[model samples]
Target: ELKVEQNPLFLSMQEGKNYTIYCNYSTTSDRLYWYRQDPGKSLESLFVLLSNGAVKQEGRLMASLDTKARLSTLHITAAVHDLSATYFCAVDKSYGQNFVFGPGTRLSVLP
Candidate 1:
């Protein structure tokens, strides 16, 4: 069975600071996705990492995948209050398989 875990499930930071959220999977997976959810809202797709060393960035958020290590990271640079939300990482063992999601990391950016 594949399981996913995230570190520092809850994070509190000040605006303009930088932080990273890590996702680790118990099994090998070549595809990873990052999603964001605001309170009482649906999840929003942030990034899709399709291969080893794949990296994507939008605005202040960046995401990378390292398939060899079964790890993915979401890096937030210059965090702002608008970026405060729950972030989730999901991985699938292979194509067409159900994705296993990490317990979300709740982030709060104080002004």
Candidate 2:
């Protein structure tokens, strides 16, 4: 069975601060995705790390994957109140298999 875990399940940071959220999985998977969800809202796709050493960034958020270590990271730079949301990391073992998701990290960015 594949297991996924995330650190600091809940985070509270002030605006302009920076932090990183970590995701670790039990299996070897080259495909990983990062997502965001606002309270009571649907999930939003953030990044797709398709291979080892893959990294993606948009605006103030960046995501990276290290397949050999079965680890993925989401880094937030200069956070803002608008960035307050629950973040998730999902690993896909195969094309047709269900994605294993990490327990989301709920982030609250104070102004």
Candidate 3:
């Protein structure tokens, strides 16, 4: 079965901090996506990169995919209070028929 898992369900980082969240999958994938969600808000779509060597970024967050490794990375450059939210990376393994979402990474920005 194709599944997704993320480490550190909760993260507390000081202002101007950097971190990385890892996403691992159990099987092959055709596309990978990154999403961010703020408190009480719906998912804010981040990236929908296709193919193996695809990478995308915005603000303090950068995401990359490795089909060969079946892994994805979300690197946070410098976290701020505004960046305090939950992040998730999902994989489209079934070509839109099914989506496997990671456990999610909740970030707390300390001022």
Candidate 4:
């Protein structure tokens, strides 16, 4: 077990579509984060789900975390071409900046 797991490394979502991606982890973690990245660009903060049942959303993206189950989710609503990018969920193991990232979800939102 590599501590964290994410499924369907790639997604091709049509415009106006909706989808959900999952993240599962082992052991206890301090924080979970969802980040978006454009091609060859730095990460853009999406959501930071802190505790159990913590949910946060912005624009067409929503994220939720369940600490007890060590799980997290990122949901996309009404996808658009501008949403094409990579999404990553990282788990903070240490109190500091130590983080483990999922393989990443590569999304291609086509019109």
Candidate 5:
């Protein structure tokens, strides 16, 4: 069975600081994804890591994947109040394009 896990389920950060959220999976996968969601809003795709060493960055957030380690990371740089949101990482299942998601990391940026 494949399982995805994320660390630091809740994070409190000061504006302008940097932080990293980790995602670990129990099985092998070549694809990973990062998503963000605001309170009372649906998730928005932030990145799609398609292969080993694949990385994507947008604004203050960057996501990377390491298939060898079955791990992925979401890095926050120069966090701002607008960057506060819940983030999730998911790994693609062995079959098709289905994905299993991690719980979520709720980030709060304090100004």
Candidate 6:
């Protein structure tokens, strides 16, 4: 059975602060995906790490994966109010069909 876990399930940050959210999985995966969600909304894809050491960045958000350790990280740089949202990391191992998602990290960026 595959399980995805995320740390710091809740976070509160001030503007210009930085933090990292971690995702760990029980099974091996060649691809991992990061997504974001606002309250009562659907998820928006943020990053797709396809290989070891793969990294993606956009604005204040960055994500990377280390497949060998079954770990992935989402780093927040200089977080702002606009970056406040719930983030999730998903592991896909069933030929792009099944995906196990981590418990989302709810981030609240204060002014």
Better of 1 and 3 by lDDT: 1
Off by over 4 Å in 6: none
Q: Which stretches of candidate 4 lie over 4 Å from their true place?
A: none
List, residue by residue over 4-109, the lDDT tens digit for candidate 4: 8886799998999999999988978748998889998999988987778899989998899998889999988998899899999999888576889998989999
Who is ahead in TM-score, 2 or 3?
2
- lDDT, residue 73, model 3: 88
Cα deviation at 99, candidate 4, in Å, is 0.9
Tens digits of lDDT, candidate 2, 43-91: 9999988989999999999999999999999999999999999999998
CA error at residue 16 for candidate 1, angstroms: 0.5
Per the 3 Å backbone cut-off, how many clashing residue pairs does candidate 4 have?
A: 0
Cα deviation in Å at residue 42, candidate 1? 1.1
Candidate 1 lDDT: 0.94
Give the count of colliding residue pairs in each prediction.
0, 0, 0, 0, 0, 0
What is the lDDT of every predicted structure here?
0.94, 0.93, 0.87, 0.88, 0.93, 0.93
Tell me, what's the RMSD of every candidate? 0.8, 0.9, 1.2, 1.4, 0.7, 0.8
TM-score of 1: 0.97
Q: For model 4, what is the error of residue 44's alpha carbon versus the real structure, in angstroms, after optimal superposition?
A: 1.3
Q: List the candidate numbers ranked by lDDT, top first.
A: 1, 6, 5, 2, 4, 3
For candidate 6, the TM-score is 0.97
Q: Is candidate 3 or candidate 6 better by lDDT?
A: 6
RMSD of 6: 0.8
lDDT of 5 at 20: 97
- Stretch of 10 with least lDDT, candidate 3: 91-100
Q: Which stretches of candidate 5 lie above 4 Å from their native place?
A: none
After aligning candidate 2 to the native by TM-score, how far in Å is the CA of 67 from where it should be? 0.7
Q: Candidate 3 residues 2-108, lDDT tens each?
A: 89998778999998889988988989895888889998999988988788988888878888999999988888887888888998989887886467889899989
Error of 6 at 98 (Å): 1.9
After superposition, candidate 1 runs with Cα above 4 Å error: none
**Residue pairs that clash (backbone atoms under 3 angstroms), model 4:** none
